[model samples]
Target: MVRNEQRKLTATYLNGVGMAVLGVGGFAPVVSMTLSGPTSSIVPVLVFGCILASSGLHLLARQTLGGLEE
Candidate 1:
């Protein structure tokens, strides 16, 4: 049980790092494109990035909370 707990903690931390990278790395290109492209084209890219980041965070939170509960 303790080993499992440790594993879960590690997974949660990794998930957080992945989410951070996804947010920054994923949005970097969108930010660049928005600056160079038309407003209409950039809007969708920004919205999609926002959605992706939020969902990743939600999943990360769920994983962390589940580990805590266990």
Candidate 2:
């Protein structure tokens, strides 16, 4: 039981880290570029889309696992 709890904690931590990276690394640059000029419009959209997609995947995976636990 302890081992299982540790594994779940680790999974949650990793998911949070992945989200942070996607939010910062993936979208921050595009946002900065957009603020500087109009040429970066599409870039921010693309990056934001990617971040959303990835975060969705992570949420789905977590939900699936939680369902399995029931």
Candidate 3:
């Protein structure tokens, strides 16, 4: 139905966003810091990235599982 299609589309978007954030916000900073020497605390960046990635994944999972009330 249209609802299911919408869910799939939303899930796809969420997945893409999660992957992008994981790469740019999470791993990219860690890699950059390791290669160039950290001038600031990497913990905050890692934590922030992880939170964002996990949130995105969580939303994607919910949509993929098909939940209109969730």
Candidate 4:
């Protein structure tokens, strides 16, 4: 049971990292495009990307604290 819990925790931690990476990846293109010119249409995508990154970071922080407590 202890080993199983550890495995689950590891999985959750990795998932949070992966989500954060994906969020940054999603934003990269939008940032590049914006550097060149106006990006009126991609505003929603940009917002989504920011939200995803913040949420992922939040998840990661929570998991980290939980792990440290354990």
Candidate 5:
């Protein structure tokens, strides 16, 4: 069905974006920590990374959940 194909397409794009952001977010905290050292200031960077990664995860979850959400 077209709807099913659309879902697959959407899911594929979502997964690509999700994984991309997740990879970037996963490295951000480490890069920040390595460059800046462990400090309260790093908390913001870590939080930013966490937020990005969480958003990516949400997208991935949506991709996995598929039509259940629609």
Candidate 6:
């Protein structure tokens, strides 16, 4: 049980880190570039899509890990 808990915690931590990295990588550049010049309309759309996709991936990982624990 302790081992299982540790594994779950590790997975959750990794997921959070991945989400943070993805969020920053996806949006930071667009925000910086937009301030310098006209931003492409698609840039925001793509960044938002990346955020949604990353969130979905994180949820999926959690669900899969939960299933493994069961």
Compared with the true structure, model 6 gives a TM-score of 0.56
lDDT of 4 at 16: 71
Residue pairs that clash (backbone atoms under 3 angstroms), model 3: none
Each model's TM-score, in the order given? Answer: 0.45, 0.53, 0.66, 0.42, 0.53, 0.56
Supply the TM-score for candidate 5: 0.53
The residue-level lDDT of candidate 3 at 62 comes to: 70
| Cα lDDT over the full model 6 | 0.72
Candidate 1 per-residue C-alpha lDDT over 1-70 given as tens digits, one digit per residue, 9 for 90 to 100: 8766776777677677666656665666568667887546566666576667667765765676565543
User: Model 5, residue 48: displacement in angstroms?
Assistant: 5.9
lDDT of each: 0.66, 0.68, 0.73, 0.66, 0.68, 0.72
lDDT of 6 by residue, 4-70 (tens): 8776877787688658757685778577777897567777777777777777768766874774554
On TM-score, the candidate that comes out on top is 3
Each model's RMSD to truth, in Å? 4.2, 3.4, 3.7, 4.6, 4.3, 3.3
Residue-level lDDT of model 5, residues 1-70, one tens digit each, is: 7777777777777776766665566666667778978766666676577667768666775865467433
Candidate maximizing lDDT: 3
lDDT by residue (1-70, candidate 4, tens digit) is 6755775677677677766666666666567667887557866676677667767766765665464434
Across 48-67, the per-residue lDDT of candidate 2 in tens digits comes to 77687668757755864563
Each candidate's number of clashing pairs is: 0, 0, 0, 0, 0, 0
Clashing pairs in 2: none
Over 1-70, each residue of candidate 3 has an lDDT whose tens digit, in order, gives 7877777778777777777777777777778778988768866667586867767696766758576433
